[model samples]
Target: MSQTNNRDGSNKRSRILSSDVYRQRENQSSTNVAQTQSGLIIDNETALSSEIIKEQLNSVDDIITQAIIEVPTKHLLYVKELGDNLFVSLSTKII
Candidate 1:
């Protein structure tokens, strides 16, 4: 999905539909398959770019990305924790 630049240059966040995100994922999957067939390696840096993450999580209102202090190239993507119990559950599921 191509995003249009605002003429006013304001930092306005637009709401992305879940369907759009799903379509984008499908397109990427096909491209990745082609790349893999051609012997290309998808590295961490390419796979985890901020723009890609933002596009993937566009429908999520509270998506966040925080760089690992020791590893600038690595980041943790998550939503804000609403509560301790919720965090525990999410972490458990993720792990």
Candidate 2:
């Protein structure tokens, strides 16, 4: 199994109150990044000027749009599985 480390470099595991939601958000964020990066080239290609391209790239709406495009529909299932595993681990600790 894969393990993640805390900021302190300790092997301790931490649980969040709403990890399912958090994971979903994280997946979405990553998807958005991928989308934005892929779209940057196309967006830049159509710009009349370098300044315009830079301005569009910097806009919050454009960023969000790219994210919306890149977000995969399949990530929902993966996030759910992660949440279930986390719940099981937490329950095991409690017992």
Best by lDDT: 2
- Each prediction's Cα lDDT score? 0.51, 0.53
**lDDT for model 2:** 0.53
Clashing pairs in 1: none
- In candidate 2, stretches whose alpha carbon ends up further than 4 angstroms from where it belongs are 1-47, 62-95
Give lDDT tens digits, candidate 2, residues 1-95: 13443543442223443565567755666432423333542222332678877887888774465334445467876876787887665546453
- Displacement of residue 59 (Cα, Å) in model 2 is 1.1
- Give TM per candidate: 0.17, 0.21
Minimal lDDT window, size 10, model 1: 72-81
Best by TM-score: 2
State the RMSD for candidate 1: 22.8
Which residue pairs in model 2 clash with each other?
32-67
Model 1's lDDT to the true fold? 0.51
